[model samples]
Target: MSWSIKNWRRNQILQREGIPDYIWQKLISMRCLKGLNPDELMRLRECATLFLHDKQINGAHELEITDEMRASIALQACILILNLDLDYYRNWVEIIVYPGEFILDYDYADEFGVVHHIHRIAAGEAWSAGPVILSWQDTIHTATRSGHNVVIHEFAHKIDMLHEGANGCPELHANMSAYTWHEVFSQAYAQFCHQVDKRQETIIDPYAAESPAEFFAVLSEVFFELPLITQQHFPSVYEQLALFYRQDPAQRWR
Candidate 1:
């Protein structure tokens, strides 16, 4: 089926179910979505409905999944793909929600061929072609205007994974230049790492220094939540992200 036809069919099916007004109200309460036009808001609602239908969103550890909770998560996740489509998220079929932080067993090999195992606490995680696990506590707390959002951060990693692995570079549009992406992000990441080493209190999270992939995800959080800081600190990276996401959050807020 054509893209338009598929989308229309999805919309038709969703119209029968009908998203609750409270869901839309809760979504607009989010700072990132405050200034969206009516038309854009409608599209976002449709996309979110499609996301909820296609993905299995389950609450873990005896936590009950509320309609509000699902709507909030689905709204946030679908926002990233407003200009794109559900196909971007085809690799994942489930969104598991925990009450709080979750633990993951980490295994690694040493130079002497030794192996080690460790447990790492995480707010959210996204595996290549696997489910996305998140902490509902963190998700609700992270919806502020501050530059922190596990939903956006993990989804950004999924986007990066679309082109090979999550290496800070997702597939670019025809007009975007990969050379520019590499040059700009390389310079920005190095500088950010240097600042982190210097013990500077930076607005961008220090966790971004972990890896190139992490740098991209962390910056994506900033792009949507605190777009002004992103535009001021690394305008080129923000420009690239705006082009990729097809949204100008700073302008919307302004």
Candidate 2:
């Protein structure tokens, strides 16, 4: 059957009903939902239905993944789909959750073939064609409007990867001019790097300087979290992001 707002409420990710009021309240209160409005909420709910229907969410470690947990994650994750589409997340199948901040082991090789031990802490990750991993602790606190959402960031990566590997460039709509995207983004990315090298604070996070992909993800977070601020500081980058995401968040969020 075709997915639509008309039939969305009739569907649920889980058949086990009795969803708590608090869960609904949290979802309803989310800023991302606000951009959707009441009518759009219905469509977003349908996208959530599809997300829950297709994706398998797993609770890693000792975490007890509850209905609320799934619902909360689905509600926000699907909003990107509400505007874009489900195929945006084509590569991943699971939303793995660790109870708290999980440790990731990294190995670095030297000229002498010596391996260096490296550990890193992350709130969430978007693997290429792999499942998205997130920390429940960070996930729970990551309010949709805070300009720092792991789900949106990871999903944005998925969108960026659709064209090829996420070099911060995605398949833009036909109406969009490619050269404008390149001109704006190149200037902004370069300026952002210069500031980062000087250890200077920027309106857009300097973490964006880490890589083109990271710039996309970090700016994506700020796009929704602080759309007004992002547009104000980096209007060029903001326009490009608005074009790619297909949403005028600076306007909607305002």
Separate clash counts for every candidate:
0, 1
Query: In model 1, where is the ten-residue run with the lowest total lDDT?
Result: 26-35
Candidate whose lDDT is highest: 1
Candidate 2 residue-wise lDDT, 78-181, digit = tens: 76667778887786688898988788787857559999996888878776778888888877787733567777777778778778777888888888888898
Highest-scoring model, TM-score: 1
lDDT of 1 by residue, 1-254 (tens): 69999778877879865569967775677765767888888888888888888888898999999888888888888888988878889867999999999999988675588999968999999988898999999998985537889998998888889997789999999989999999999999999999999999887989999999999999988888888889998898999899989999889878
lDDT of 2 at 107: 85
Ten contiguous residues minimizing lDDT sum, candidate 2: 10-19
Q: Cα miss at 159, model 1 (Å)?
A: 0.8
RMSD of 2: 4.3
Error of 1 at 176 (Å): 0.5
